[model samples]
Target: MKISRLEAGFNYAVLSLFTISALLPLVGVVLSALTPRAEATGGLAIPSSLAWSNFKAAWAEGHFTVYMRSSVIVTVAVVALTVALASAAGYGFARLDFPGSTPLFFLLLIGLMLPAEAFIIPLYYNLRGMGLTNTYWGLIAPQVAQSLAFGTFWMRNNFKQFPTSIIEAARLDGASEWRLMWQVALPALRPAVLTMCLLLGMWTWNEFLIPLVMVTDESLRTAPLGMAFFQGRRSTDYALLAAGGMIVAAPVVIAYAFAQKHFVRGMLGGASR
Candidate 1:
């Protein structure tokens, strides 16, 4: 079957419209970041002379080096732990039959529906009691738990759609369960795993409430939280604000640029499955 020319044209037009809509604000922000502070009316005006120094100013004054370091540590830890733990649990739920499996999986799904806001207060008290507050663990542990919920769900769906024939063949060839999972199924599901990593990376990097509630140390602030403070101090300076915002956003954008192919494949394949 083929789309008619009129329909194809209409689809393209709609996509183009949506693309422009998405890009317009980003364009405005980029232009604003580049414009001199005095001339930054914040309405998408092209700068006569680029204010590249705004980024340098924001970086030093906002203490972004410290913030970015903390962000990287937390994000990396969350993604690594979530991916490893979630993949194992997802495989167990999807492939192995056990007592209480259905109910247990449902309980895990509860994490997906509940927002951090619902338990943040009690969570803070709990972490404080454990003496984990204002530490890197304070930031990392909760995020791992949150990311795991979604990561497990994502990987389980992918695993469930895996070919049973391959598993059977591997079993007959004396492949242990561990070997089969680590060597065979996981490799085949690279795209899905990568997609999970990218999604979790973005979420962890942008997480504000968890860090805000968990840590008081200025050094422990993540990029987004740091940007909030930066914004407060430079509220009147649009150029600096935009530059700071871009600095915080750059890592996720760079990650996506590198992993976009795998991300797209995983999404489309998961949908199809």
Candidate 2:
């Protein structure tokens, strides 16, 4: 059951190599962001002085304030809706029996295989017709639908793994189905819910194609789409580009850093169940 010293050393070496490979680009980006515009020749090098001004310049030029607000609003809305709807659907499929539950779950699973590209054209027209396009709902609605399939599947498995005795006790105490779902079941599935929310939030935040297609107004452009525009305009300005990139990526990184414990637990729990 124990790994030999040589094998352990080999594994450590392999992991270290992968770690460094992953970190090297990030290191280059951070260094580039700090370098002066003139000095950043698109090559990674320690700058003579850290130029915090690059971020300021990028912020103003990219209109990141507006873009970040859009992204946050869309992300939060999608995540909130996805988590709420998915948890309910998941618990129903896992615990409540219905005539078509199996078929319905399979139908939902079909969504996971559907590429956004397939339905984007119809979706855009549909949203436009509904007067949702160029608004936050235009951005939020599709992502919630896209994320729900996986979220439902994730929560269903986790809910299925919950202790039966606990639910029975709650039922004995006259807990209504709504009370059981909100108070007992959901609280017990916090880690799984949190994990799904984080994943969904990241997806919604980073979504480019949907927002790009749905919103023509610059104000509605999410961070990623705005970053793309900034990158195109400032392709030669590596420092500003790097700064913009960092600004766009920082939120998801910060969120993950804070909630990684729950994220890991949720993934493990879902996998085990």
Candidate 3:
């Protein structure tokens, strides 16, 4: 009994060490953001005075409000498209049967394993052909495509775990295919939906690569790309950059904080099944 207790205690100590290690940088950023702009380069120590004005300065200098709008529009659109398309594709792969369905699904699943960087050039030209470069549609369309690969893969696995008995019973009760999927199978997918929503939302929200590559207009920048410009302009000020980091991370932190429980449950359910 003593040995088991000691082992458990040691494991907890390791876990605590890891947890603190992960959080220290975030804490430092927050502290730096709250300090005066002049102290941005004043090393890692806490400043003598707290300066709430740093947040305002980051906001103004970064043009965060405009970038935020662009970010929201892109994120929301991508999430919605990813979920809708992935849910349908996932359900189809798991439940429906037709010619070439398996092969087509395999092609999509293969895409999930492929690196997105491999497609950057092709994607760029494709966007240019669509005449969508430097626009919101160009920004969102590609993100949706990149994210859909994983989304479909995620939902496909989840749907596979659901018993077909219920679906068959619904079919016998005069339910159409759409009705069975929408009213029955989908309701049981809450955990998966939550998991996917959280995943896609985070990815799309924090995305910089696609936006940076596809968009060039200063007015159309997403938050992270906009922050790069902000940094260039305020390159001498480390405090403002730290504050900008805080601002960028705050919404994600708040969202995860609220949805944490469901997020964990969803991940476990999908993985365990």
Candidate 4:
């Protein structure tokens, strides 16, 4: 059904208004970052001269080189492990039948409903007992477990909706289950997988509370956690605080830009199904 011209115009107008509302803070942050410290009045205003040095100052003061390195290591490891394990689990849940499968899957879903705060204290003690605290593994392990529930849910739905004809044809050709899953089914699910990766990467990258409670090693802080500390020290310096915020946010923004096509496609496809 074609929309009326007036309806189309109204839709466009609403979207534009929402888009601008979302972007205003980002635009303000950018302007604040560029404004020289002396000229910054803790409010949005165009800078007379770009204070590019603020980024440099924030970088050094925040020791973001170390923080970013830690964030990358944790995020990459968590996403890779979560995706791989979740894909296998999702495939099994979607395609296989076995004893306790239904009950086990329901148990797994409990992870999704629980908030991080619910178990963080107990989780810290458990990790500490295992000598994992204040280490990269401490940070990486919890995030992986936390992500797996949603990751499994996401992939299981996608896999369930996969075309059965292709699976049957592969089986007729004497393909093993592993071959069918890794070679045939996964390729068709690339968009969904990429979408999961982009989301998990962002979550892992921006995780602050997990890092805060899991590790006290200054060298082990992630970008967001580091930015928190950076903010505390630079509370009075609006320009530097804005610059530091951008530094922490830049990676997620860049990743989303690159993967937006796959992300949008995956979301739309999921919605359609």
Candidate 5:
């Protein structure tokens, strides 16, 4: 379908407006990061000096290395566990017929409906009892539980879309259940897996409330939690804050940039019907 010249122009204008609106803060934050402490953008004028040192200071002050390490630990653990458990759950739900399986699956879906805030009090008590609070396992356990709901839902849908014929053929060839899942089915679910990892990574990395509520030890804080602490220390230091914001954002942005194609495809592509 060929759009008219006027229509195309109007669409382009609308696109430009939306794009700018979305990115305006990002632009401001980047520019603000580069601006000097002495020169306030009182107006959005070109900065007389670029304070690239703000990035370095934010790093040292925020103890970014520690936070980054903690964040990576939590994110990697969460993604690995979620994919494994959810994949198993998805496959069972899709391919197996057991008593009350349907109802059990819906119980998992109920997780998607309830807000995380609703479970915080009870979850905290559980973690506290386990003596996991302020520890990596403490942070990881809650994330895994919260994630299982959506992860299982996503993988169930993904599994439902897979061809049953392949699974049957694998079984005919004497492939064990584990082998079939690991060697055959899992490979085909690459796009969905990638999408889930990217999504989960971003979510866990940016998570603030969970860390805030669970972690009291300064050393155990993730980047976002640490960023909040950094923000409080330098309340008037806008440039440093912006620089720190950019630091916290950079890794996830880079991950998405590399996975953009798979991410987009997985969002729209269903299992082959």
Candidate 6:
């Protein structure tokens, strides 16, 4: 059914207002980042000249190159591990009927409710005992575990919508379980997989708590954690801090821009079922 002209106009007006509200802060950040040190703190005024040096200063002072490298390694590893394990677990839960399946799935769902603050202390000590502290594994392992519950839930929802008849037909044709999952079902779950990857990458990229607690070595600090320390030292330097924030936020924004179509499709597909 078509909406009335009044409803359509009202919806557009509301959306436009929300869009402007969201964009104003970002525009302020851009302005602040480009403003000279003295003018940046003065609020959202156009600067006399673009302080292009703020980004360079932020990069150099923040040691963002090292932090970015660490972030990339951790984010890629977490997303890869999460997708691999979550897909298998999700497919199993969605398609199979083993003993204790429901109970186990519910147990896994408990992880979704648990907060990082609740487990970070014990997790830190546990990683230290395992000799993983201050290493990439220390950061990666917990994030993978943290991501798995939701990944499993997301993938399970995607897979559960597959037709049982098609699965049975593939099995009858001598397709092994692995073949069925990877070759048949997984291809159809591409949108969901991409969406999960995007979401997990964003979460891992922005994560500060896990890295802060588990990593004491300066070199292993991820972007967000590094930016936090950078801000602490340069708290008075608004231009530099804003520039640092932009640097940390840019990659995720670029990635989301590219994958937004698949992301939207995946979300709508899941919700429709």
The candidate maximizing lDDT is: 6
Which digits, one per residue and each the tens of the lDDT, describe model 4 over residues 1-273? 999999999999999999999999999999999999999877879999999999999899989999999999999999999999999999999888889988999999999999899999999999999999999999999999999999999999998989888889999999988888799888889989999999999999988899999989999999999999988888989999999999999999999999999999888774232
Candidate lDDT scores, in order, read 0.92, 0.92, 0.85, 0.92, 0.88, 0.93
Tens-place lDDT digits, model 1, residues 1-273: 999999999999999999999999999999999999899877888899988998998899999999999999999999999999999999899998999999999999999999999999999999999999999999999999887779989999998998888989999999987887889899999999999999999999999999999988999999999999989998889998999999999999999999999999999885232
lDDT of 6 at 123: 93
What are the per-residue Cα lDDT tens digits for candidate 2 across 145-181?
9999998999888888988888899999999877888
lDDT of 1: 0.92
Instruction: Point to the candidate with the largest TM-score.
Output: 2
What's the C-alpha lDDT at position 56 in model 2? 96
Better of 2 and 6 by TM-score: 2
- For model 6, the stretches where C-alpha displacement exceeds 4 angstroms are 270-273
Question: TM-scores, in order shown?
Answer: 0.96, 0.97, 0.94, 0.96, 0.95, 0.96
Q: Lowest-lDDT window of 10 residues in candidate 2?
A: 264-273
Indicate the TM-score of model 6.
0.96
Better of 1 and 2 by TM-score: 2
Q: Which stretches of candidate 5 lie over 4 Å from their true place?
A: 41-43, 270-273
Task: Identify the runs in model 1 with alpha carbons over 4 angstroms from their true place.
Answer: 270-273
State each candidate's clash count: 0, 0, 1, 0, 0, 0
| Runs off by more than 4 Å, candidate 3 | 1-3, 270-273
The 10-residue segment of model 5 with minimum total lDDT is 38-47
Candidate 5, 39-87: lDDT as tens digits = 7452355677788998998899889999999999999999999889999
